[model samples]
Target: MDGIVVFGAGGRAGRAVTAEALRRGYGVTAVVRDPERYAELAAEGVSVVRGDVTDAGSVREVAGGAVGAVHAVSPFSGPEQGFASLDPDFFVKAADALLAGLASAGVRRLIAVGLFADLLGANGRPVMDDPAAFPPEIRPFALAHTAGLRRLREAGEGAVDWLMLTPGGGLEPDAPRTGRHRFGGERVPEGAPGLSYAELAVAVLDEIGTPSRHRTRVSVFVPREARVRRT
Candidate 1:
């Protein structure tokens, strides 16, 4: 059977995607910076490769023979990688490196994890730009993620076949999966923001099998009932 390379397979979203792909009987290569960190996945019959997407050559080598790749790499680390590296532009840098690596590896199809950039405030600007958009601590992350979306658009268009899966709500673990979701682009959708990372993975893997949103930024909206229970 063919395989898929999932960069940052250690992350929550990446792990979900890996497991989903494996459940469907597709060979999965879990790529991470440190192989030891993802030893558990290796034991699960996955081909774990200690590779960094930041290093194009290494990714190129690791991605060989894979049918597709997922850009789940994120550089924000409060203590593990140091908080100083959490800049919006740094997100762009990592994405660029991943793009170069994918291109060199001959992988044409890519489904990336992106943030909600289409959320506009009264000022006609992204909610991330508003000081009150979110708590100060998390604002930087939102900004960086939004910037990541722009970087994906600016870089991925025409160069690579890519889909930026922007979930409308927080990546909630408890959110119910109805196998249902709505898709859109640019402008953010209105409703409660809560998308199960597990369900989000389904969207990613589904697109990989039969991609229709090539080189575009798309958002998924789960039903409001899926996010909150009735009293």
Candidate 2:
């Protein structure tokens, strides 16, 4: 009851965050659409529950008595899953629900994972806008993610202290956790090598324990030299 509540706990990022939270000795409440699907996630200190990230009522119900919350939900998982069923306002709804629900539940911190495609490239344009940098077909998904980020900004110092950690490059699931990452501003860092989901989880948990950023989005990546030396 006194640990973090993680939405989309079945996803790779969500699972990594959950694992990291548990490793840090924090009890976890893993919220997923279908609790049965993630039964394996239920452990001695972890509880897998059914909840909706876009529904304020559901979020409030599941996130009650939590230290903080994580929004790791993704409507589009991969390129194989086309954008036909993707909702442009999915993240907007999520932002609204999370801000309201977390506030109502007395949880102050909200950390949302972000898409790398929306990060500005060296050309001063979104990576998604550059076909050479990102897949044009995935632009819609990036737009939705960016819209959610915009909603969070528009909230403007509301009850929930939120931070969006946008990956500068790729998120390698199979990579090792070096426990090292670099943070950047709006634009992607020069020669930014990506970090692992585990490393991302480290950043997420670090923020929850001792928040360094508030109501802003930052690019998180591993420097090319750091990646080479650490790996």
Candidate 3:
């Protein structure tokens, strides 16, 4: 694998992944619908391209010839309590575009940032299927993520190498990247379940080159029970 392409490259997770990849000396292409908004990525020697996850033609043009691509595009914001609101079908369409684009571009690998909603909970069912898994505010995005995972499975699970990385159901905002976190298949990482954006980025980049979680789900979480009150 040579360079990497990032869809939704302007968002928090996407930006972190792009910066980390550059730091590790891998060429990167940041695909964004608005190039001006993410001009900083271009300034950092990354290849900035105008693209949208809903447009297959544009996606194919930008993501072609890359080693892999990360679908980290998140645009909508929920109520002040959480940033998790979007049209129900947005991610499904995004998944469709990614599938068409990667197939056309001949890119064989895709790593998507998934929600904990799709990860199996303690009851051995995806959180999305379990009622009361999240508050009403986050339900829209959670359902969108669930739909996106289904689309990915239908389109690329066997056709192209794909992986889903979930952040243990949620994360702490504005936390330091710490370069510290832990990951497991589908269970929570002991306690507090939160993983920093920076550490999650590390796990994303690490998985791209090494590919330990292909065609499966990997949950990166905070280690040692962050914020646990000692007895």
Candidate 4:
């Protein structure tokens, strides 16, 4: 897209996504809770706006005048690293504000950053369908993310063109970007490989430039065999 807004621009994945969007020559405005936290982004010539993710008015202000909005707002902290205590309703609320803001401003395309737990597994089952599959600590967040995707999918039909990028389990700071990734249907392959945040950013930018991949959710990953086995 020629012009786009990115929420959570200060976040880990958000930074990469914004950088990629800029690399593709798309004008970008990065929404952040504290603009100071992302000084580097500001120095990079990106338009940075201060706004709270939980506030509709604030989110709306930044969402205006952009052709595409990427919902990359994530509030997770490192130590806790779990979603059980996280408010599930906040996701829905954010969606409401985002959609409302888009509707009022005439912006129609939405690209969201979602968790892989909502994706279907090898047996045609959602990743959350097999709760026992992952560590107990992370299940709650996974389920909540799945719910968020459902809400986005439902709201997208009216006028917004939405696509959710469900990142694999092993996202990391150093994930590689070969600029090539595989797109699967509802069910992702077994052993769910990992993808670098940089690569995920590239994928999102690709979708932004190519509108045909709309109203869809796809997983980001690298094959297991290509992964380096660590000790």
Candidate 5:
């Protein structure tokens, strides 16, 4: 209620965001498909609940009274997972649900994590358009993500204000938090380094607390200079 509700709390980014929120003393409503699976996420200031990101009723029910909400849901985790069951409209459905549900629940701020493949390359084409840059097999997921972004744009800045933070490079799951990141425009930052989940969480919470950007997607990554220098 007083804090933020994270939709995919069981996943890597969700867990990182939850931890970062807790570290910052913000109460968290960690939403997962199965609460029992994320029992470890429940703590003094954290509430683990079962919710579906694609279902407006579920989003409304779980997001009630929250200051902000996060959309970190991903239907496909990796190449090993395959795209056989991946829904092309997964993100579109999520965007619709979050917009309608959060508005109904009175939550005004929404932060949705984005896929990098949709970012433009130097050649003025989406990174996904170049097989050498992004795997062609993953194009469906990229297109789905782009469609969701489009849906959000079409909705405009009505009741719910949303921002999508796309990682410019890979996400190093085990990397440490440097508490530093940079925001870029439509094109991926030239030499931006990969961001750790912790760093990404920091950016997410920062925006929630201060909210510099609005109703637009931005690229987030560690500056090459911000990378930890090895001895």
Candidate 6:
């Protein structure tokens, strides 16, 4: 078994995760729709594979023979009607397609990137549990995240080992990797200093070799004072 497969390796956080994993001496297979777009990734020792996340064969070709997989892939475009329009089935469609491939290829461990919306509030209840919790402009995306979480949970079904790394509400792609971090079980406190993509990449690479944190949702945060905050 080599290193993990990085799905959606061309995205902001995805690229960071892949690069950090490579730096840590892990063999990386960068799965992307445009493999050529990541010629630099190949130049850096990643095996680039082009595939559709929603297609099972396409996924297995990339995920096979791996100890673990980092599922950073997402489909930003899909079609559905009504509230279902807000359904995260597009994510599920892609993930389920990948999961089947992973199962067949005997790749069990999985680290998935989920949204902060899936996390609980100060009261220890999921924010999505209250329809009024989020603003109208964001509810659709939040609900979509909830849907994706549900899909991942159902896919686990006590058969597969997996973890969902949920970012805090304020997470962004700014800042550099300080290698500073704290871990939260299922519900990291809301409004905490959120993580930067670079730091998140560092954390993911660290967690990969140590699977003690298996099947858990780890929330990320930066210590206060490292960055500016807004009201």
Give the Cα lDDT of each candidate. Answer: 0.76, 0.91, 0.77, 0.75, 0.90, 0.72
Per-model TM-score versus the true fold:
0.87, 0.97, 0.85, 0.87, 0.96, 0.81
The lDDT, on a scale of 0 to 1, for candidate 1 is 0.76
Better of 2 and 5 by lDDT: 2
Model 5 lDDT tens row, 128-231: 99999999998999999999999999997689999999998999987768877889999988974689988899999999999999999999998888778321
Which numbered prediction scores highest in lDDT against the true structure? Answer: 2
Per-residue lDDT for 68 in model 1? 85
TM-score (C-alpha, index-matched) for candidate 6: 0.81
Candidate 5 to truth, TM: 0.96
Off by over 4 Å in 6: 77-87, 123-135, 156-159, 188-190, 225-231
| TM-score leaderboard ranking | 2, 5, 1, 4, 3, 6
Give candidate 1 regions above 4 Å deviation: 77-82, 121-123, 225-231
lDDT of 4 by residue, 23-107 (tens): 8888899998788777888899899889766676776788777878888887665426655558877677777777777777678
Q: For residues 28-84, could you state the per-residue lDDT of candidate 2 as single tens digits?
A: 999998888876788545799999999999999999999989999998998999989
Cα lDDT tens digits, model 3, 111-210, are 8888777677777876766677756656677777888888877764455688888898476556666656667887655552676667678788888888
Tell me which of candidates 3 and 5 scores higher on lDDT. Answer: 5
What CA RMSD would you report for each candidate? 3.1, 1.4, 4.0, 3.5, 1.8, 4.4
Best by TM-score: 2
Q: Which candidate would rank higher by TM-score, 1 or 5? A: 5
For model 4, the superposed segments whose C-alpha errors exceed 4 Å read 79-85, 129-132, 224-231
1 versus 5: better lDDT goes to: 5
Candidate 2 residue runs with Cα over 4 Å from true position: 228-231
lDDT against true structure, model 2: 0.91
